[model samples]
Target: MKEKLSFKKGHRGRTVFLICDVIFLVLLMVCMLIPLMKVLVDSVDPSTYGLRLIPKKVDLAAYKYILSKSSLYQPLWVSVYSTVLATVIGLLLTTLAGYVVIQKEMPGHKLIVGSIMFTMMFSGGMIPTYLTIKQLGLMNRVITCVLPVSLSAYNIILMKSFFEGIPGTLYEAAELDGATPMSIFARIVLPLSKPALASIGLFIAVGMWNNYMNFILYITDADKKNFQVKVRELILSDGLSGTNIGISEDMLKNAMVIIVVMPFLIIYPFLQKYFVKGVTVGAVKG
Candidate 1:
């Protein structure tokens, strides 16, 4: 009788827990949705500038005005080129580093990993970094914005952990088959590393896409700023003065928020499967 009661109690508890989980998820969706709906509705609303659940009239002038800015194009181009270059370089270095460190027979494997991890704990101060960049004559260059920030210690560790999860027999077999390290990496390792690559590449791409501090610090040229910097200026500034575009600050702000996040929303769905698998693999192995 006691065992029966205990089982009944446990079953009831699980039912309650599941219900609570569903409730929590619904509430979270509501919280997120309300803000998104407000932004979407307000961006096109011609109504007076105040919070409302619905719009009086749909006016798309804000998006049109913002899109028409010639200044926005240069920053968009900068972000595109810089993000692509940075992701490519970051993935290449991360893959190479992860592959090398996983080869326990390689000289200084632990030393290399330890050195990489040490960076996560400490960094040269901003002043010293600035001086180093200045000395290298890279202060105002686009490379300055991407190269320094590209190789993340965290990503390297994650990649290393992911690679470690791969079966060692595969490497041994390749070696026995007279496969060179480069050939094995390109042919065998890379084919199996797609999940880790997607996860890390997405991380690097997002980081570079949203990067602004580097541009703000390294580049002095007004025309060379990234979209993030331009968005910051737009959000913080008094409404575009001396312009005939009849749009409110709130509309532009909402539109900017949507524009910035839209790319990730579009890209993430495609990579969701790989990202989930990769993150799980890296996390468990690490």
Candidate 2:
């Protein structure tokens, strides 16, 4: 009778714990859902109902207005070009660095790893970074956006950790087969590290796509403006400031927001599986 009572108590405790977990999860999801739902509603709404939860009317005029304007296309192209270039370059450099540092016998590996990790914890502030960029003669050019911040320490560390998780026997086998380091990286490591690579690439790509500070500071030419900076100018432009800009202020603002967010929304779903797996693998290994 005592044993049966104990089993019943255990079952009841588990049921209570599961009920609490469900409640917590529901609340967390709702917190995330509310903001997303609000954005969708606002994006479709004709009128900006200030601070209201719901819109009185729905319309796609804002999207239409933004898409119809030819002026937005150049900045969009610039953003795309810079983002793609940066993502590719950054991924390659970071992966190479990570792969090198993962070698246990590499000379000064500890010092290199320490320095890289130190940079993650410390940074030369914006003024110094801007000054360095100016010295490099990257100012007022599209390359300024892609070249200045090509390699990130956090990404290198994550990639290194992922690489470290691979079995040492694989490296030994490759060595026995007369595989060069580059060959091993290209053929074996890369294939196995897809989740990590995809995650880091997406991260870098998103950062590049959303970058405004680099473009604003380095590229003074209005013609070289990225989407975010261009959007900012459009948002702050009062009707009296420019009669020929064509698009209305409210419509432009909404449209720019949509444009900024749309790419991430579209791409994230496709990479959702890899993203989750990469994050899990990195975190577990770390």
Candidate 3:
């Protein structure tokens, strides 16, 4: 009778837990979706009133007005090119650093890895960084944006942990077949690490795509500034001051927000599978 009673209590507890879980998930969905719905509704609508679930009338003038501007095209292209270049270079450097740091037999491995970790907690101030960039003749160059932020200590550590999870036997087999460390990394390790690479690459790409500070500090040329910088200028200043567009300021802001976010929305679905796996795999061992 006691055992039966205990089982009944346990089952009741599980039922309560499941209900709470469902409630929490529902609340989370509502929180995220409501704001997104508001943004979507406001983007095309001219309503300056408080948030609404749906706009009474839909208008495409805001989008049309922004798209008509020829100046936006250059910044869009600059953002795309810079993001792609930075993501590629960051992955290469991160993978190399990760692989080297995980080799137990390598001299000074601990010290090297430790130094990389130390950077996660600290960095030189903005003035010093700017001076260094200036001294290197990187000022006002697009490459400055790519090179300065390429190395991430967190990415290297996550990658190192992922490398450590690989069996030592695989490295031994490759070595016996006269494979150099580089060959093993390129042919074997890289192929196996697609998930991690995709995850880190996505993060780097998104960061580079949204980056405004880099342009503000390093890039002086208006022609070289990326989309975010342009968007920021539009947000801070009166909307289309010199341009003869008649769109409302709120409408333009909402439209620009959607325009800026749309690319990431389209791209993320394709990479979602790799992303989930990558986040978990690197985290599991490290």
Query: Highest TM-score: which candidate?
Result: 3
lDDT string, candidate 2, 1-286, tens digits: 9999999999999999999999999999989877765666666664656654577777766677677778879999999989999999998998999999998698998999999999988999999998998897878999878865668988888888899888989999999999999999998999999889889989999989889988988899988999888888777764112225543455446556767888988999989888888878788876
Candidate 1 segments whose C-alpha is farther than 4 A from its true place: 1-18, 48-56, 239-243
Report every candidate's CA lDDT: 0.87, 0.82, 0.87
Which clashing pairs does model 2 show?
A: none
**By summed lDDT, which 10 consecutive residues of candidate 2 come out lowest?**
239-248
- Pairs of residues clashing in candidate 1: none
After best superposition, candidate 3 residue 142: deviation in angstroms? Answer: 0.8
The 10-residue segment with the lowest total lDDT in model 3:
238-247
Backbone clash total, candidate 2 = 0
| Candidate 3, 181-230: lDDT as tens digits | 99999989999888889888998898899888989999999999999999
Instruction: Please give the lDDT score for candidate 1.
Output: 0.87
| Residue range 1-286, candidate 1, lDDT tens digits | 9999999999999999999999999999999888877888888886746657688888888878778888889998998899999999999999998988888988888898899989999999888998899998887899889986679999999999999988989999999999999999999988999999999999999999999998988999978889999889877785433135677777788877778777887999999999999999999998
Q: Estimate the TM-score of every prediction.
A: 0.90, 0.88, 0.92
Clashes (N, CA, C under 3 Å) per candidate: 0, 0, 0
How many pairs of residues collide in model 3? Answer: 0
